[model samples]
Target: MVDSTLPLFDEMPPAGQVAAFKAAFDAWLAEQRGSGSLRQDGSVAVYEDMWEAFAAWCLSQSPVVTLSSLDLADLQAFQSARFGRKSSDLSLTPRYALRLMRLIDRVLRHHASRTEAVANPAAADWIAANPEIRYADAAHADPLPEYLSVSEARQLIAFLSSARPRPGKSRDAQAPLTWQEVRNRASVGLQLGAGLTPGDVRALTLDSPVSQGSRVRERPWKLQVPGNGNSPARETPVAPWAAELLQHWLVVRTEAGIAGTFLFPSTRTGKQWQKPSQYECAKRVLEEAGADSREGGSFRLRHTFALRQLRRGTSPQQVAGWLGIEPSKMKRYERVLPGVIEVV
Candidate 1:
């Protein structure tokens, strides 16, 4: 029944009606799935769980939850509770829970869309303000970011330079070194030179757009990287050396008869290989480079690049953009480097 005093078109189902509402919501969710709007990007189930957790919190309330009864303050309360920002049964850890709050907002939006109800004002506020960078346990001392020494970094780069370069503009960029060598050199180059995550290097396409400044300077090339990690698709700087290596690899890749959309497609599968294979390849490069197994791995390549940038006096904000990570996350790298502003 419609209530004239109520804000929504229909009342949020009472406790007895909660079961029915759940069934109906499930039906709506199925519809969303069928329509392909609720795309499975690995977080769909998590959203559902978050929604169910919100519902449980509502059910445990003093006056009980309903359309009119659940106001803006109530929504804020739920946001706090879910992230352990307030007292609740949700076990979400403080580290990732702040990020998880956005998913909870998404669920509420879906509910509001289906029910024609007043949207969660608190969630809107949280999304707008995006909350300050308040991590849990602020008192804890952070660990220093790991990095390779300049000598080791040089060794790492030199070790991966297996492709033989060809001279002359008329010739292809590289001579025979097998397709695997081409892929290995290019892969490591991007991680170390461009500060790209391993996944980003793998996901890069042969036809993926590249942007370069016309002024013609060193490291002028930047890749419009596809979305990697939690970051949106953003332009990432590619050092001149890495760019040179990439052009060379393209020639060898063609010679080896590898054809795929990916910049470094697997010769066996014609698609990007997973991290396990990437790790194996990285270990081989490290072995050849004489880099300690404990010190150098696939991810450490990115860390080395990031730390170098910090050492070069780039601001944390700038480095964060370069590496596709949160600015606050850069503090770990910053703690190790002394007086960034004074470096230049």
Candidate 2:
């Protein structure tokens, strides 16, 4: 087996060159880790694994051992070795290989800039020349995102509302819940009501604002506020139905003795909120109600609400603010997906 610690320098390098290269790599890695750029996650692990494979293949081909010793010929050979190999096919995609190379290039470039090493130019050039190339568009069919029509949305809600609860007295019992009828309606209402995301809904605590007569407030939606990061905060208005459903949920909360910060607690636990679980439950409800639209799922509720707001003459800027999206991103929603909505 190849020595994992071997540097990529020629002839295994002199003791001094090996020490210098190791020192440079150590320092660069420290900086990346400390600066929060390099996450110690599966992505980084996969990149490292590919790099090890490439390094091993290079060592097998040439006497070189340190990154600095790698040349254009070695780069080409590494790509060739990786291309369509069994390991590559089974463990990695071409995209994965390309990503690994780019990550290696980034590390090398960082090291080169700091160390003023000779490898910088070649590494940079290789990265530029063989960047994980891609076709402009996907080769596979691009099924336009499935979306719900207004009528379909209405039907979905009606179906979910009418679904009988499972054979039990518990409200949480399995029932034909429709997004339109309950979860989807509730989701759309919350989004329209308070401009909340699936995350925000999960994060909503009892302390979140509500109406006595006709008012609502909460910390900005999860995606809107800057607390998670440096992103700016935005406050958006909620639609009437969202406000009502939220109010209704509060009533259910009281009966369930659901006391906590989370606004949308699990019907089972009634004490904690989980976005994925709730979404899945919502999907189940929709499926049971037979509310599948051309868009195929409840994601269209969000789309429908946004499109409705736009068709009502809401400006892109306003919609963007409401949805907690950058205005540039709002341009895509200016026109609703075909069959997803009708003009009021």
* Global lDDT of each candidate: 0.63, 0.53
For candidate 2, write residues 26-139 as lDDT tens digits.
576678779998877785566556655655565555465466776655666666666565863744465554566666677677777886765544444444333233211235
How does candidate 2 score on lDDT?
0.53
TM-score of 2: 0.46
TM-score of each: 0.53, 0.46
Best by TM-score: 1
Identify the candidate with maximal lDDT.
1
* Tens digits of per-residue lDDT for model 1, 132-223: 32223345545454567667777777666545453453345545466786687778888888887767877778655364552443223777
List the candidate 1 regions with Cα displacement exceeding 4 Å: 1-142, 166-176, 209-220, 339-344
Model 2 backbone overlap count = 25
Q: Candidate 1 at residue 303, lDDT? A: 79
Error of 2 at 310 (Å): 0.5
